[model samples]
Target chain A: DAGITQSPRHKVTETGTPVTLRCHQTENHRYMYWYRQDPGHGLRLIHYSYGVKDTDKGEVSDGYSVSRSKTEDFLLTLESATSSQTSVYFCAITQLLAGGRNEQFFGPGTRLTVL
Target chain B: DQQVKQNSPSLSVQEGRISILNCDYTNSMFDYFLWYKKYPAEGPTFLISISSIKDKNEDGRFTVFLNKSAKHLSLHIVPSQPGDSAVYFCAARIFGASGTYKYIFGTGTRLKVLA
Candidate 1:
């Protein structure tokens, strides 16, 4: 929904290798976010961008970094893949509506496996 | 530790019955709460939301009830259908020290609606 799409929907990388996931949106929404989903952990935010080049870290940003050099693109990079980082990654966009309330729309997702 | 919590890991319901999912939060300052539904191999989709100022919000067969005092929230789906089976996530939005809004999410609750 929200015209969001994620690249390389499935990937497998070895330990110590680097991997980057791409998130693309066509709606031009102002907020973009990266999150990882694991069993019993729900969805944990890794990073979010309010505008181009205005990215900030989330609670689970320890092993991940993000960049948003354009309005439609947000990327997440794992410096070195680890087994603990093996999870399904999701990209989301928050539509800030009137009255300062907002709702988030998400992309299909990317499944990453680190061995 | 997670700020948002969904204690129940899974639930099973009969078709045409009401399915109730519960969520709790440790942070009382969250002003906005939302519920999202996710199917296998897909990202989550926004379902409904309730503001801290309001205790209840409804949209057709789905209703969200909030108790600010107890820091609890629940989602109700009437006449549950087989397609209604999915993982539900509760998200809480709170303003951060940097003046930006941050969302905290619960682990998730999987609901199985039997035909």
Candidate 2:
């Protein structure tokens, strides 16, 4: 909850529909990450951005896309939502500190349900 | 395949007792490990982290022990408090080809501190 906020705290959507989740940070951190949490899968990173316009895939990048247009905003878009994607989504921000310490701060989270 | 695994799905410990949560990783390239605590409806917050070069790291009543040879890590909380009851996640960081680190998280262990 450190200076991070996720939009649409809860959402109910239909399968095959497109959905976009927003993450805003006031901390001005350089790195932002999108993750999904499920019952058996703790938290799987979907994508992360190191800087504006610089994004990369994560372990579970399939069926998800991300964009960072500004330093404070990172967006995660589900091009075609699926029932398998129904999970709690979280956004986290982090800055590289001295000695290579990277501690991420997370938003409250967005619960998305795909029917 | 899951690189990080937390076999225990839930754990309960009495107040003033020690609670130990364990995690194992299959990847040897991981350079750092971290612990995060999550509440019912909130995003995860960073609790502690340890570099691969270190065997143990401690802060206040929480201590993390890493065994590189066994590919195991454990978090120990002394005098567990009700406030400490939550889902604990274990994550491992590996350096990516893009010069950034990617994190892989375990399924998580839910800890309940009985009052």
Error of 2 at A115 (Å): 1.8
Candidate 1: CAPRI quality band: high
Candidate 2 chain B lowest-lDDT run of ten: B94-103
Task: Return the interface RMSD of model 2.
Answer: 0.7
Off by over 4 Å in 2: none
The window of 10 residues in a row where model 1 chain B has the poorest summed lDDT is B94-103
Clash tally, candidates in order = 0, 0
Please give, for residues B1-115, the per-residue lDDT of candidate 1 as tens digits.
8899999999999999999999999988899999999999888999999889899999999999999889899999998999999999999998766667779999999999999
Every model's TM-score: 0.97, 0.97
> What's the TM-score of chain B for every model shown?
0.98, 0.98
Model 1 reproduces a share of the real contacts of: 0.82
Q: State candidate 1's DockQ.
A: 0.84
Kindly list the per-residue Cα lDDT of model 1 for residues A1-115, writing each as its tens digit: 9999999899999999999999999999888999999998899999998899988889899989899999999999999999999999999999988876789999999999999
Best by TM-score: 1
Q: Model 2, range B1-115, lDDT digits (tens) per residue? A: 9999999999999999999999999999999899999999989989999999999999999999999999999999998999999999999988776887778899999999999
